[model samples]
Target: MNGESKIKINMKAPLKERKFWDVIVIGGGASGMMAAGTAAKRGKSVLLLEKNSTLGKKLLITGGGRCNVTNNKKDTRTLLSEYKGNDKFLFSAFSKFSVEDTLNFFNSRGVKTKEENEGRIFPASNKAEDIFNVLYKYLGESNVTIQSDSPVVSVTKEKEGEYFVVKVKKGETVFAKACVIATGGVARPETGSTGEGFTWLEKLGHTVIAPDLALIPIALKDKWPKKLSGLTLPDIKITTFLDDIKQEVHKGKILFTHVGLTGPTILNMSRDIGELLKYGSVKMEIDLFPHLDHGALRAQLQRLLVEQSNKKLKNVLSILIPGSVVGPLLELASIDGETFAHSVKTEDRKKLVDQMKSIFLSVKGLLSEDKAVVSSGGVELKEVNFKTMESRVVPQLYLIGDVLNVDRPSGGYSLQLCWTTGFVAGSNC
Candidate 1:
């Protein structure tokens, strides 16, 4: 589906006095659209406010536009553990509407989903448009009104009544009995997730945690990484060290970028890297053969040498490492890449094995928030009711999605949180 043609909201709808909607969901992202559609399904008049010309701007780019819908994990605790802060805060929400329910919701709407490795779910068509189409259809069928290009500026609660007044960019005041802040976080600002909801929540007596870039690429201090850009190393383990102390390790595919490192493994550990950077310089080690230890790697290298004794050392090493990364790996080990494999000394083989086992890179910093897949922080979890997603400080106010303080890795966990919180908020609101 064409991205522009989706989200059929009445863009030309004039701003005028109308009956107060039961719920006004600010931000038409994954969570906002879900909340609006679910509330409208429950017979509530809903208005979905989108800052962009279309809804689901961020959603369309999720999972490289295929949109990892949700994970297939049935264990609630295991699922919540993927998140960063206060995993227990989502117990009520996930218990109410889970990953299974998310899959069922889409499947029931004729959008078939399939699970990939690690329980990551994606549309059977491999098109994020399919997921958005399901939501757009739901919004249309539920009679949920949407206002595109209508960015909500501030939300103020009435002193004498239970209603809240939502002020848009043009100073138009839209009244609603309940307000759901689904505006998302600061990640991917081009997608309209600029963390505006954090400011609004802060103004309304909620503690807004300072958001940092999460699930994003990391900038490296070494220039060799730029040469290895575009090469993908699969099943490698990356360990992050904070001032020489090991903090975290992740194993998955890592894609080399012009600036630094990306892919699931690096993005998942980026939050820890961000924190580790604050204290001192951060360093990371890559274990190419994580399934094998040093002695086993040496044995494997020995076997490779015997198998390809006539080949150049670089060519022999290329069997274990990517062709693009082989030259650099040999250089780091101070070994001549052009040396004959059979003539290589045992000490040289050991150095090669050590370098292959623990490739080192000093992390310069993280990419900006706009480059992140999800922001690391949001409204502090203590201020919101996990059961209804309602704000404990402000009655009739609900915060969901990236607006909460939950941060999860890729592989469908983040979107799963969105689905769970969005559904729970919609069910209660």
Candidate 2:
């Protein structure tokens, strides 16, 4: 494959005159771009098809445009724990192209990345375009043909053998010896991730998992949370219960939104929230002071009242909670903000302590799938070979990225899956 021979094509090209390709990748997200470039760099005639006007539309907005490339958790076992279900399927892929390999790949391409809190990596320039430019440059130098705005109308396998005929809109069909479906999941439809790949896989005798929202903001049923919108608590613990039974607990930052909660802790627990809602009623308790037990919190409150007898109750509470939440706390405790600390009855003080320790909120539901940061479902993992990212049910057909049923957390694990599986598929295909 050489730049002189490889050329970008459009739908206007005669269908019959289209060059047969060694590999044809559908979608131009992180996985498709990486797969096409990797295959082309290995001397394969690769064709990258993107329905969007440009490649890496979703990648441009990842990590709020900073693009968290990957995480620092280099150990495969520990990293696997961050995922939700069927994560063992990633062992082979992660082993082949670990986080170190990802960093090395980008570093070699001159996209210097820096590590942030929780081992998250971002480009030194803090621009997602820089990351995209690195991949785009690699694809160009490797002579990978790119086709933009050419949405595939249908995909069909030849009557015999391992060849695939990909038909695009306007009656254009291209042939390839191998095909990679990297169209991603239905997380962000605006980014061209409408889960079309799953439909194609299902037609090819593969089981497609029902896609749902993952890493999405949750809506609260109470109006109190809405009034606290834009307020961010640095350290808090959230415990989710289903029908009065504790299900799970997470500790981290929690941000109040117009409708509900959105932050690392809440988003991390959202998948379970969606699942638990089906079984029974879902409720979450927020511990304003997770570091202290109930007894310790009560004792601390008493000490605060003793130390500030002349101060207003609101002033005494302001030391423990943010000022924005002080008024709401007093209201929840059924105490006036202007009441002096010494005048507060023991029962009122106890109410204040209990409210401070555990504030409960009813769970409504999750946002739409398209608004999710990462989708939860796709082609069943058992149907694909993780070692090569090739479909076991349909030979010569591969699946990568969100099109597979691997649910990862927010940080950078999802993109790492794209890089790893895409590279494996490209190298094997």
Candidate 3:
């Protein structure tokens, strides 16, 4: 049948009919689709229900439209290390459906992948649509039934047997021998993640850890951050301090946002700051020249000043730093930008050296959850078996993706979690 014929047939089908499935996967996001495909391929009847008008809404926007499908790291130990909250719980799942398995799963489906810097794997076509298309095609070929705009209201386990009855918004019901909850966390509400999965799981007598924002930018207390917005500095060391004690230090590229600091260095330190913020105020120090010692930085500045003695102090600094930062550096050093380099005092020279080594900034709080890339806290891992992603309390019910309490550094780790857990749940379902 052609596309129009299929649409007519779907529209002609009666609504609110009872259906039975061997495996019913809720939330047609990354994990749900994977679970549905895997279960159907294993000869189990599967039904994939999505709340939105289409599937993979979040997947389409991932990695700025060029989906970072999975991390290239094959070592489970190294991959698990990137996860913060529940790294140990994923041991069995990763062992069964490892990163290598994720790469192979996509490659076999004709979605070619390439490993970028820091082990991030992206589709060679540089389009997230390719990944979504492959998954959609795989689901179709696997005979998985997909229903869009079907929001699950609740899931109740029948006391007599190992079956479940899932109720939808319009009072329609679907019965299944097993159910997999792949509903994502409440990070991107625009993509249909509104924390509904947590509520559903809670109704099923599961304890859910209150979700919190993660992988979001920090808001700074200082006004200078707004001025430096859009400016990016490479090879910078970011140190987080709580009550004058150094808490964590990360070295990478740093980007100045309108509110505070962002980029890889700041993102890696965000979870630490989020944890510390519960206690008291947190301070951050950025070492612009992390590779250079204080003495070496001072000598380098002195040499630049000596070589360009005829130029103004601001002009001399343009060589060491970007032109946009010259004014701010001079302001922090308490030196007039128009002052001649030859006339700079010893005290002012020391201040300039100090500013170049450590640029201080204060963080008030993190950006709102809506701006976060992924959420941190969710269902605690202790309640679920990592090997199958099945709930220990409720048999045959599995949880995967961001709904679980696990957050990792940027570079495709979060998506890998979805793929790994989804693969395991689908295989076991």
For each candidate, give its TM-score against the true structure: 0.91, 0.88, 0.88
**TM-score, prediction 3:** 0.88
If the candidates were sorted by their lDDT against the true structure, best first, what order would they fall in?
1, 2, 3
- Model 3 alpha-carbon miss at residue 232, Å: 2.7
Q: Candidate 1: which stretches are off by over 4 Å?
A: 1-11, 17-19, 243-248
Q: Please write out the lDDT profile of model 2 over residues 317-425, one tens digit for every residue.
A: 8987888899888887788989998998988888888998889899998888766888888988888889999999989998999998887788899999999999999
- Per TM-score, the best of the predicted structures is 1
Model 3 weakest 10-residue run by lDDT:
1-10
Which residue pairs does candidate 3 place in steric collision? none
**Model 2 TM-score on a 0 to 1 scale:** 0.88
For residues 16-121, write the lDDT of model 3, one tens digit per residue. 4538889999988888888888899999988888888788899898886899898888998988888864567888899998899888888997888898777889
Q: Where in model 3 is the C-alpha error above 4 Å?
A: 1-18, 84-88, 110-117, 124-126, 305-312, 339-347
Score candidate 1 by TM-score against the native: 0.91
2 versus 3: better lDDT goes to: 2
* Total backbone collisions for each predicted model: 0, 0, 0
